[model samples]
Target: MSNSSTYTTRFPLLAKADTPAALRTVPGEHLGELAAEIRAFLVEKVCATGGHLGPNLGVVELTLALHRVFDSPRDTIIFDIGHQAYVHKLLTGRFRDFDGLRQQGGLSGYPSRTESVHDLVENSHASTALSYADGLAKARRLSSEADRDRAVVAVIGDGALTGGLAWEALNNLGAAPERPVIVVINDNGRSYAPTTGALAVHLSDLRRQADGARPESNVFIELGFAYLGPVDGHDVSAIEEALHRAQDLGRPVVVHTVTTKGKGYEPAERDEADCLHAVGAVNPATARSSIPAGQSWTSVFGSELATLAAERDDLVAITASMLRPTGLHPMQEKLPDRVFDVGIAEQHAVASAAGLAMGGFHPVVAIYATFLNRALDQVLMDVALHRLPVTFVLDRAGITGPDGPSHHGVWDPSMLSAVPGLRIAAPRDTVQLAEQLREAVAMNDGPTVLRLPKATAGPPIPSLARMDGLDILHRTRSGPLDVLLIPAGPLASAALEAAVLLEDQGLGVTVADPRWILPVNAALPAHAARHRLVVTIEDALRTGGMGTALAQACQDLAVPTPVITLGLPTAFVQQGPRAALLAEAGLDGPGIVAAVLAAHPDRRPPSAWSATTLATTPRGRDDHH
Candidate 1:
């Protein structure tokens, strides 16, 4: 039967079922019918909401087997890369809320803690599930409840295995055999793109081996865990049988299930790139993005970097298992020799980039802002300490709406704040992205970063003047500035509109983009000295972000320009529409106006910025770090 085909009749068992508990009452014979229903439901709902459709479609039978065989909440269950947890949510009585997924005050695209008691770990970052499972199992053993009958299950994908943390947890689990835990290796064979490294090849070989007596060929057995199938993951009965065998062992065991990445949907399965991993709202009849492929920051970087690579043979590009997502395809295609895909190992990518830099090659390390957290120490010690001319291109630098808190690229700046000789730039648009990228690659003295948000790349905001690499976008008066509106990256356009709002209210505003936001450019504090109030806005944490650095600079310059920082709040921002989330965090023009007015009650704020408006998204993740 085609996955896209609708059932002739309504679901018999699943239609009225509210939760996983209801599934317990379902007859064993009805399992196949329920699985079919769930698959169809996912295809319809996910397409409407725009989410991780492919991952969920791949896990329908596995999910059914999991819920049927194991008692969740009573028996702990955790999903790494929680985007595949939609089936879990629906089984846990969230079927009605499925249509509202990824919207404000609606269903989250990933596992949300407050959403239910069944979800223990709402982790989105890959490879942390094993470590989390180990810790929980150990805690259960160490405490007075040591004798309790409970099991901890971690469903981790093969793509996540490329990370070092998984091996670290494996080593620990192997050393102590007393802890009873189940590690379900969901081997779909892709992470944004095809998964790389030695383990993937090892697992691929293991998948072809027959079950039972294959212990001699198994690596999990060597790690002090019994190895169970190369099970048919799409077959609910087989998967359940495998789980039963794992439970019977009463010790750490690996239940390897080989499944398709995008099993049901024709479009997703046929997609060679990313398997439609994460997508926007698509037509249910035909999986196509409603949003246009406008030149995003990722695209701009890809094209420009590819151009740079063509000109220079010494330039090398590296990505962490995300070639297409991070926009390295152009380079990967044009100069395959220069491109390096280090799998999901961010730590290795950064360190290897450092090695590449030392080898007389200028390495451009392209990675997601959130994922960079894994490689902080590596980048600091290996790259920054040596002050190599390695350019770190952080693609999704701010609030990545649907993927939830774990996916947001907010903490990169605050984490890298102490790294000396490190420079950071936030480009306002496509033109600046190209210019800053070229400058970063050309600079051979120290490490640099070109950070941008995950949104459409718009027109450039023309600068009225340039001082010490900073672009002065707007200035109210020459004599004494009332407010110095220092906007970071994409927020420059919005700052311009905010200036108009303040100006209409008789408050002079000077909006400038410190192109290189880090190191507190020498000209910034001097410019602030002329202003009464220095207002800084970023899409990152205001505490240690660009605003924090600027405030410290003001203190050092002995300039008493009282600074007001505006950005995202200090918390785990929930999944919603990107624009709505920004508005909620007071990063929008109206919110900026309200904050400006609240800060300066005497000056007040105009009702509107003018006929012309600026749409700015901050480069920071939160208000304070």
Candidate 2:
């Protein structure tokens, strides 16, 4: 069914059901019914629109129980990694618009403060809720307003708990005995892949026991917060009772609610390992088969890295709880001892990898571009400061559709650009990604970073002429060079296409996708010197992207070419198809051509508008990396 049709069909759920069956039912009697309904609703609605699937499925009952007891907006509920808040959205008067999920100007994939009053926080990033909870709780205490006697509840998952920031928040919350913040640990035993470490195994043991299980309280208890439950999360009444108990306790408390990933779905339950954590657009009946067969860029990297591991026994692989997504599962499967799944702890992933590198082993720290924001300090201090040659394979390092602002990998290049001596590589194709990975692994002087998009393949463009600094993909024939196109990440195809379009319009264009687009290549200076207009396009933000860097390089080199940058704008872009976002940002083929013409008005032909030759332009294979 179409999203619009589904929205119409499910609109009535907007008005909170009068004495809903879940609300009326006693703690134990048919508690799982509401959960079942929620799961079915989510599958039906989300599959059509393609929002966060595995997360919402796992926390169905827990979300229902929280809303049932707590008066939201008054009593704040902050969700860590808010992608799992679909059930929360449905109950809080957002049911009608739920099917319009993650579309442009529609309901966001993550919680949004603007959407409704029920949403206290709009955090999509992980390991941030606990800290927010601490601030809110403390602020309420200091105000001493009678109306401010509200509860601050942070629904943090086991995955988010792995982050050092979560621990820092926990420590502060625990230290403040006066503050009343309830920490709900939604333990599903997975974060992308099955969670790792002694803590995960310990939590698993606690959840498995039915009776008299001494809740091993280390992080919360050691810090002096009361800990409760290893409760069956599917039991709505049980969850309500636990939440009430924690609220009544009047101090910081940890309510560890144990649930199953892909709870109500039989397929999800049996398979395990974060069942269908995310789903792409596909026919609902064949959703499972939608992910194409054969290797993704991640799989290729993993397979090749694993082979590299065999040659060098000291080679170790690490991931920040993204074993499956980052394609490190194969490496883990082959070399269990060498591969480390560090849970949702990005800082630990980078720092630990640095330590491994320091200890005479080659460590590859693989992570999603967005998630790596949490580990900037560690990367700069522990890795780059020590000059450790840690290779970070950044997955999803560009515009990620549907997941929205928090999920977009647009800021990695900007942030990483600040780290001195960090060699950053943006591969244009799968072959380049593999080759770059090998190159990064071999580099021993300093930290090496390779950024690639979610896609695996693109049109098979022939290997470009390799110069010392840049790979010259295309060079215009004998004519005044009007434009120099710099391709960053997967946008190389678009740049090349734009070049072809401009070429037909009698504007000579030179296109280059820098193999290592970091620290400002020497060839960029020469290329910019030759062209009348210079344009740099990347999937990252324009503020500190390759465009800015190239512009800076030009300034340092005393070049006077007018630089036109094309990329994601400063503001947060909403979730939608990647093509839509690119077009909106004026980074698509026509957009690029338009921007180029705007910069070089004199270069445009007299009948530029009358004869649109873009359609007839011979298309090349898009080699996406």
Candidate 3:
């Protein structure tokens, strides 16, 4: 916790305007001072906690103005990509809690409903806020006349409008012009990197027009929206006035306010790469990350994919507004024409990749696993049904930390496994990532996916032997196989550690990595038959996931061995360290050992287990395996 006296002294105006009600009481003239204070506070605290610093820094005044103009809690406000709602959180009496932003049991990086009444949507995904607003407004109209008077504002920007859902919501909202829904386009002209595609060009034109003559008509006007702005988002007075006019209109309105992402911070403004969009714990003075650099799973895949692309003229890569973050920048830098940035349109990217594949090009659609959920239909029908040679390299495939539930990549394997011809690969380390990627692209018949976690790629874990497609990571030197442990992707390390602990208890154990996780490798069931018990560990949902599929495969093959699967439950996991979450979920070394002992047919009692082992057992069973 920060010193209260020091905090109050630094930002006197901010101290007074802790809540929206209190903010409304603040003198209008001192609002600029308050905004400045908020920016400084954000730079200090967010940089310290390592979160969406640039997005939050960009929206200080806009957030302040919205709270002051609209009666929040009564008049609901929804931030599109809720990372920009840090300012909203601050104004809603969360200023003191800023110290714990994105930490476990602390304030989330995005809007969390449990955190405050001011936050209507906990969405961190790009777009979808307008749809939420539209629903809320319709509900208000149906509920009561008093509710109808309440305004619904959807604050969307940073390339969120590029998403198809945002357009769908705009279409619905525009049709009902009488609905008092304020669509604030907080255009900073970026989503991680600069916003791409035709929409970005259109917004650029609008910005240019704003500097000169007022345009008579625009896209918003054509959609039946009362278009306002190209207003300066930093000017709280102008934004409040525009918002007030929008309120009086009693109709759907579009207020296009332009703001600088990473505003007031020189380092953020100067940063060409994501504008310091998201950062680790940083030196506040220089706005540089304090954490030491390391090669990540994303980097390994990116480097290898670029190398492969250079070798194969037919290979191309695509990203939906995250070229740099997804590690497509290497390929983009080397072969400019082959890499595509499709804005915040994952659906379009996947469909386009299918088209690319159909044209004799094997397209690699590199994207975050969570974002892939948006285009599952495309991956299934458009790609898999057609059997296109498109490799989806999913970065951040598992339990991603800090960004919270919405950002976790736990659903991809379960969902993608349902696609008939799609093959999924979970690389155990950097060596396997490169090797598996080659295998993924070489397959000419159907679609393939390579999923990896967000953590740094540790030293390579070499396979003892390759059986069929599975990598034998560990095996007892001389004993009957008591338990077979199958780990998905990076969990191979943890599985090996558990094997050693099990071996310490005089139990023979075998650990295997199913590099190709989906379709349950043909030889897996036969191997399961060799052991008395089989355990599968993954950083995905327990239901309908890798474990479930493997168990079903074993049952089909008449392998009588009992299969006990360990994975995250079907629930929204909160923001925290990935390591901590995995340990809590019983996916760690000690946790895995405990689960194995509990399930093993020849298991010894807990009292008989080593004291060192029992001391490390995870506390609760309700949330763990």
Candidate 4:
């Protein structure tokens, strides 16, 4: 039989052209077929490309119901953390481009504004949709066309209410009875890891309560929202009915529709550890993917930390709903009592980590670099001010490639610079990671941070000399230094390559990985003074990062060397491969050389610089040394 016929026999209604209208027209008999088809489609496409498969599979019917109930562009639907928006994208005229999910110049893993106006919020961060929806609703109310019956729907899943942002919006929205917004809680009892908090407990109680019957104390109802049902989210008609009720309310309402996390696919359903929240490129049928040959930076950190935890009785691990993702789960398994998964509340994570440290325990708060920004105030006031012995392992330090702007961890350097007494270490490779982990834990006076990029653990480059806390990886002849390249973790390889290139072009080079990137090494300025021009390279924004600090240090030490900082521009980097993004941002070897050349035209390689330019070029001769 033909493929069409075979698919028809299996999923009769779904084998045809699947559109919003087509989904709406699907016969009641074949609703199951359509759901199955969507699941099949997700498995076939998402598995091969590698994406948030389990989340999409869980929300097939819910997505269909949402599209059927709401006129998308007219009635705004904002998905919190956008990972569950795959089924929404599939139904909203983007099924064809689904093949290129998370790829460069392709459909984004998360919702994109360029793709459609239907995607109101592009933020991949959790528990943000409500705030966006609240703002949008306020704008709509202020506009002349405020009287229209347009629905504002915020689909939040996996205990997003555990966060303060959602609660703040909820308080405002619920207090104002006239403002219309349908808050759909896609309850699946997770947020990367199994969500743990008082809010998560409350949600559990809500889930346990009978359908359409308010619990003894309903938070939603008490908060001025018309609570609908603990409905079956997997059932399309049931969810549609709840949504219809919400739309008819003409006020703030919450339709608690509980669905399975990783619903249909066996591979995801069976796997209990996060239900394969995100996956690599894998076989569609078997859900199999090849693991990286060597240990990843995450795995290496995890292994080392676990060993450290085993030795130290006071050592504890903490995560904000990301156990496996940040590599803290291993330590958690080894020392269950000491590990804390603080739901989606990073603010709480920081504050509690401070508390733990105050209690004479060494708290290692392992979290994503981007997420650490959320709890900066807590880090500054609660942790740093108190001089707590809290070690922050910031995983995914820079250019978290394909997950787009909101997910990239590049802002940590700039943001963390403001924190007093906080020592930040950006490890270049696996060896440094282990060494720094020990250093971070050993510090009892103040907070220490270990920031690592999201990539495989590269082989160690032996240091020629240890200058202060920095590892001088490469050094040229003893005479004069034309350049001092100090690339942080992500751009270390590129900086070394650029040093080789500069050396070949008759330029003296010294490359280093400042093990402790923060606290600006006191000895760095004196070393930099020996250079004609100091080029500080990093993948973070050059504005307020390590490069800027070093440049300021040069001036502070009375060094005349002009510092050229090479880093990502102060803008949101687009989604792409890490290597490609680095090149585009001028963080690669060729790009670094170009940046150095651009800073000093006379220092450009002889082959690159023209005769006329060289004749007119004023600088490059080292005077300080």
Leading candidate by TM-score: 3
lDDT of 3 by residue, 531-557 (tens): 998888888877677788888888887
lDDT of 1 by residue, 1-625 (tens): 5321223235445555547788777877878778778877888888887889888888988988888889888888899878899989988978767768887678878788788988888788888999999998888888666434688899999999888898999988876778878999889888788888888898888877755355474678888988888999898889999999999988889999998987878888888987478778788778887667787889889999999999999999999999998999999999998999988889999999999999999999999999898999888899999989999999899887777778788888887777899999999988999999989999998899989799988887899888777888888764456788888899887788878877776788889899898988989889888877777888787678788888888887788777778777667777776777777666777667666665563653344532112332232222211
- Which of 1 and 2 is ahead in lDDT? 1
lDDT of 4 by residue, 22-83 (tens): 77777766777778888888888787777898888888888888888887777888899999
Query: Which one wins on lDDT?
Result: 3
Per model, how many backbone clashes are there? Answer: 8, 3, 0, 0
Residue 90 in model 2: shift from native, Å? 0.7
The Cα error of candidate 3 at residue 100, in Å, is 0.8
**Candidate 2: TM-score?**
0.91
Tens digits of per-residue lDDT, candidate 2, 1-625, equal 9755555455333233312332433344444655666677788777887767778888888987887778776788899989888888877767667657888779998889899887878898788999999898878987868745798899988887888788889889898889989999999877777767777877877776758757555556888889888888878779889999998899989999998887776655665655368776545554465656555678877788888888888889998888878888778888899988888888888989988998999899989999888889999999999999899998988887878888888888899999989989998888887788889989999999998787757755554687766788888877888888887867888888899998988889888888788888887888888888888888888778678888888888888887777777766778888887776676778767866765574855345632322321112111111
Q: CA lDDT of each candidate? A: 0.82, 0.79, 0.88, 0.81
User: How much is 412 displaced in model 4, in angstroms?
Assistant: 0.9
Report how far off residue 179 is in candidate 4 (Å): 1.1
> What is candidate 1's TM-score against the reference?
0.93
